[model samples]
Target: MLLIAGLQWIVGPLIEYASPSLHYKYYMYVEQTQYMGFVVPAFGIFVLFVLVLIKKTALFNFQLGRLENYSNYGLVIFIIGVFFDVFGGFLPGALGFVGFILSNFKFVGAIILYYSQSKKLKKIFYVAILYLLITSISKALFHDFILWSVFFYMFWSLKNKPSIPVILTTIIAGALLALTLQTVKSAFRAEVWNDYSGNKIELFIGLMIDSVLASDTDVSQIDGDGVDSNVRLNQGWIISATLDHIPSNQNYFNGATIKDAIFASILPRFLNPNKTKAGGQENFRKFTGLELSQGTSMGISIVGEAYGNFAHVGGILFMGIWGFFLGKVWLFLYNQIRKNILIIAFIPLIFLQVIKAETELVVVLNHLVKSLIVVFLFIWFAKKYLKWDFNK
Candidate 1:
């Protein structure tokens, strides 16, 4: 999965570059800011390393029988999640209705399911590609329910454990590495290393390479406020906003103002739906006090809101905490599901926000916590009803 993810990250720029004519308009809107260009690649590498480490860690080494049992429970949870998504999308006020059901029921139910039993690499890749294509096309075609169903299908695919082929894995890793290099080359061509340009990409990569590297003060001078006339609202701008808001000076739990914190918690949910509001540009400027135009800037502004609310430490803490809790839910589900069949159902739900450009820490955390409670409750019920014991 890490290899695939890395390749995807790398492939993104290549896809954009190879079809530059097609992607030019999109590229103009994306900032690919030096700081974020650096941070994203670094973060991806860090995540990959962590995943590898976890796989090697003895703590996760459950016996084969135990692992199979966990997979069984996860299957059940996946089924329940599918039903919730379906009914929530079709029924009137379904989100609210689902919320009520969840509150009353006190179980997370199944999310999307995964098909971990598959052993063929070709089959898995084809399935993944097909899933992405269908979801993407469906989202483009049908605006609501069909799109939601796409997520259910996506998550189901993600959870499935397939025996990835060595050749495919190599291809994915090589592709990702190539993409990262291309991104770096593009950054250089754009003269990102220059002093006035912030040189954030160079600095971030440098830091990742050598943790003790010190960045020049000029890097900080890049105007974070959207008021700078020279700053074009693009992908770079969005990346800058996310990076700028990291609260490096204080602890995540202790270091934010009431207003900043409030905005951090609420903005992601507000902008989750991609539809533009009337006079949205003016409204955004007024709300954020940043002179951003619509397009990806709006999405990046959401990241800015998070940073403005909590800073760097806060952002990491928020994501880390989210990852931890979500990880736990995943572990519990893995323990309970019947077949490895339901793993893929949750992937879409997990990655839905990937392209959104905002990282609303508070909203994500709140939703995740609620989800954990429900999942735990569901597990409890399953265990009791099935008369299963944890200690084998």
Candidate 2:
């Protein structure tokens, strides 16, 4: 959490702030000191959030249960998850939500399979590599690889408690991996996104191999629409820009948008036909009064949203409340893991996008609410029909 927050909010922005000329295309709307002024306090709120979340206190012990045919069930759920991923779009209307929910079984089922196996490291490595390749070739997205690896690591660390050196090495490797993928993905997409219908897996592999072999190529140099790693990671600019714009050129939303987010989370599109969309484009245009190109998308992040609704002091308080609420939710779910470790599998799904500071409140809340509903439904089905008490 700290690593992602620091990288996105502080380190990435600082890199851009210091080397403004390098990222001149992505200019900062506000002055250096002003950016720092808002950013420092914003980052402190994130630090407070983590502190609340990982607060070390004694947890109540609960009786553990052995799940019946747990590994087999896990494998079946994983296959189902893959099926949803391949053909989810074909589903119509609200049935699509079923596919979305079950799609997460990919992680949940993989976790079950990993825990059921005796050779934990070997199992996780193979699972992670397979997921990496599949997501890379099919979607050209690598966040899932990192997310699932970290998810698996959370489970491993519960028992293994890796040393400082090991933790540092993992962090460094993950960062380098993210940077490398970001660097190469633009080139990959450029070659494949156009009219190329050749084998994607082969194209991806060839691109990666070529990138590795080309020693003269500068990774920092922007290729067409590609953003450098620093700019890609830097979300502080949006906050800075929001602060500069709101209540100046346009009046404050005064909780109107926040209210929309709350309603959007609870009410489905079928019920509330005009509910705010997920892309954050509408909110960005409304809140920031800035027009983004059709291809471009950016959100006024949580911090920006807070300030937009309420000024400085109110924003700070909003952030604290938001952080505390999320921390408590985590604690509640974590406690249940003692009763049934299968519960841990859902944590990644719930907190998947919450960890991203770049996301808006609407996206976060919508995902959280729907994921919780799906999790409880799954659990209820297991207890009632399967005749398997999770607390057994």
Candidate 3:
């Protein structure tokens, strides 16, 4: 998944500069600031090392098979989430936000619940893919589809099959998608989304296919938004950009961003109306000298903001902590799944946000907390009314 995120900025420079017709945005950054190129890959290698080392620390070890008594709670939760994905799209503002978060959790829950039951799991997975695909089309953003793929990978990981066919196929498909992602996003930006309301399910399916194969011959100008758009949604550029932009411009954040994220996690914006929008969006203009246009964002990476606030060493430390957090949470999630599948759904829901390297710390953390709260509230209702009593 991290590899998928890094593809554009990683290989994009080479393809663009080598080809006469291609003009990747990162080309300039690569040509001028060559050293920054190593930051993300090196950081990734470091993270892998940290994770591997942490395993040798003799902390978490488990010998377990599939759950003997699988609960139907995952199915119920998944169904409710589907309701949100379909009807909740019509809801607006906070209501809509709540709807999607609540409804969107099936992907996480599906992992454990459906793993031992592949026949049912595949059905739910398809429904989920359909839901995410249509949503991605409507928004002209491909992150939803990207997310589904992650869930899909996790689903497959449970089996740990004998053959490596799935792995090989995914690699090929991912490479194809990475190569053509920009073109499809460009097409959607210019052509697919304008009369979007009238488009059919088949149309969306076709266009999504076109996105991977470069089936649409029309040239597109990607202006860098969302997953499929003209920008690299997740990449090392944010880290490099912060390294280059800050101190060079002498506009350091001075720990303000981290403070904002912590605060934002506690105080909901709706409750505190005048609250300064914490997160990296506010820093976008300051760092990049580019205003976030409507339907577009200069997505700030969390580690980037970490770097922006505390410089390189601090950012590396932040990644170590981040990796540790994920490792612990994942272990906790598996443990909780062993205990109760329903309520602890928050385990996977929160943990999966690790893949979302595009958002700032505040945005990601705030979203996680809110989602956890939502899940908690839902569990409360379930215990009181449904009498599940899923406390662990």
Please report the candidate that would top lDDT against the real structure. Answer: 2
lDDT of 2 by residue, 275-329 (tens): 8877788888776667888976677788789888887777777877887878787
Error of 2 at 24 (Å): 5.0
lDDT, candidate 1, at 279 = 21
Comparison by TM-score, 2 against 3, better one: 2
Q: In model 2, what are the clashing residue pairs, if there are any?
A: none
Clashes of each: 56, 0, 2
Among these predicted structures, which one has the highest TM-score? 2
Model 3 per-residue lDDT tens digits across residues 1-392? 34533553444334433442333333233242443444454457546744674464345432212421333666777777767867887876646557868777677556445544557654665666666777776677776687666656654554565357877887788756755655556556555556655565555456556554443333232322323332343354454555667768756787887787777677766775654454345777665544566645555666667677776676666766666665665555556555655433355466445556566677677767777678768877887899765442
Off by over 4 Å in 2: 21-25, 57-69, 118-125, 156-163, 213-222
Q: What is the lDDT of residue 345 in candidate 2?
A: 66
Candidate lDDT (C-alpha), each: 0.37, 0.73, 0.57
What is the per-residue lDDT of model 1 for residues 196-245, given as tens digits with 9 covering 90 to 100? 34544444355333322324342223222212111221333334433433
TM-score of each: 0.42, 0.88, 0.75
**Alpha-carbon shift of residue 392 in model 1 (angstroms):** 7.0
